[model samples]
Target: MYIGIPKEIKNHEYRVGLTPASAHELVAHGHKVFVETHAGEGIGFSDDDYRAAGVEVLATADEVFEKAEMIVKVKEPQAIERARLKPHHTLFTYLHLAPDAEQTHDLIKSGATCIAYETVTDTKGGLPLLAPMSAVAGRMSIQAGAHSLEKAKGGRAVLMGGVPGVEPAKVVVIGGGVVGENAAEMAVGMGAEVVILDRNLDVLRRLAKRFDNRLKTVYSTSKALADHVASADLVVGAVLLPGAAAPKLITRELISTMKKGAVIVDVAIDQGGCAETSKATTHAEPTYIVDGIVHYCVANMPGAVARTSTMALNNATLPYALALADKGTKKALEEDKHLLNGLNVCKGRITCEDVSVALDLPYVPAEDMIKEL
Candidate 1:
């Protein structure tokens, strides 16, 4: 199998799909690996680094896309990248297609086998490939929210951990999942008063035990969301519905009621967003004022720390990648039910039910579509 790693082209997305070490493992497995020149340069891995790891360095993305059988990328394919995709290509990356109709249609029209990392499942029914990046985004949400609360950033000018004589700023996390938990962890460590809300009792209990009562874990309700958000200095929208668009829990009316200059970091922006005003922003201009509130909704938060993110993501993706490479996409997916769950599109058909429903497209079961592959 020949695998290609193209430099990520998303705005401020510096993380590469596979690291030098990860590519080396593929080479050791007798698979040929090709990467676009400077793909890993953002993470301080030079072309020589990839060469040292036995990877062929292509001078252009066109050549890499032309030669590779499987395209391993960090972010979704841009318009040009998507145009370059051929029917023979297998794209393995994070494709948040639920919200992007253009991407979904382009993928279908390209007639390639698309496997989304975020939808891939583990034996325990958890999103393994998405977890590492989610953890990174989760932790970063607090850091971003804290910074957004400064006066220069048009925040309320309150410190996260206020002086002993002053009361600490309040932080409200909208979900108690990985993102919410990590955000709460960081906020609590910074000595801010934190409240985490979720609809799941078991998740709340787990978080309660993990935090040891340092942060308040509350049952999430419409009243709770409204009351807590209105009073919070920093609100982290960490809700997720898994392969579906995030529910708009924070309404425009709700934002207008919040304290002036309060900050909101919508971690669920990748899946559209949990807030009505949350639009995808880039690190170049990461925040905007919406109804006098600050919104930090950078779609790729982990990209800020490319080196750490690349390594962490590779650790989680390498195994499944090897499986697909070793057994071939159809065979590998057929063998592993969890991996099969990752197949979003194959042979010009939508294989993921969530995406089919989200995009209102015709559904073809993965099993049926892979047969012709």
Candidate 2:
């Protein structure tokens, strides 16, 4: 297998798909790796570094895309990159296609085999490939929300951890998954009045035990969301629905009724956000005011810490990449049901049920899709 890594072209996105160490391992297994020039430069890996790891460095993304059988990327292909995709290429990346009709159409039209990292499951039914970035985004949500709380940023003038006599800011996390757990942990550590809500009793119970009564765990309900969200100084929208669009749990009316100048960090913005007012923002201009509420909805939060994010992502994705390379795409996915779950689009057809249903497109079982090919 000839694998290609392209430099991310998304605004302010700097993370590379594979790290030098991971590429070296692939080379050791007799696979040729091609990388765009300076693909890892943002994360401190030089062309000489890639050369030492036995990777051929191409000068342009066009050349890299042309030279490899599989295209490994950090973000979804932009319009130009998507145009470069050939029918024979395999695209392995985070494709939040459920919400983006343009991207979904482009991927379907390209006739390439697309595997989304965010949909890949483990035996434990957790998104193994998405978890690392989720963890990063979760922890950063607190940090970003805290910054957005400053008065200059159009937020209520408040400190996350208050002074000796002042009360701390209240934080409400609307999910108890990886993102919510990490956000709660950070908020609790920062001495905020933290409350986490989720529909799953088991998840709520787990969070309650993990926090050890330091934070409140509420059974998520319409009333609970209305009450907690209205009083919260900072709200972290961390809900997810795998490959489907995130539910709009925070309504526009809810935003209007919330405290003036409150902040909302919608971590689910990658899947179109959990807030009605949330639009995808970049790290460049991470916040905007809607109904007097500051919204931080950077779609690629992990890319803000490119070096650490790249290494962490590679640690989780390298094993699967190796399996795909060693056995070929069809054979590898046919062998692992969990990996097959990652298949969103293959050979111009939708293979992910959530994505298909979300987009109102035809659905084909992943097994059947691969078998037919």
For each candidate, the alpha-carbon lDDT, in order, equals 0.94, 0.94
The candidate 2 region of ten consecutive residues with least summed lDDT is 364-373
lDDT (Cα, tens digit) per residue for candidate 1, span 33-133: 99999999988999999999999999999999999999999899999999999999999999998999999999999999999999999888789999999
Candidate 2 displacement at residue 365 in angstroms: 1.2
Candidate 1: list runs displaced more than 4 Å.
Answer: none
Model 2: lDDT to the true structure: 0.94
TM-score versus the correct structure, for each prediction: 0.99, 0.99
lDDT of 2 by residue, 183-219 (tens): 9999999999999999999998888888899999999
Error of 1 at 200 (Å): 0.5
Sequence-dependent TM-score of model 2: 0.99
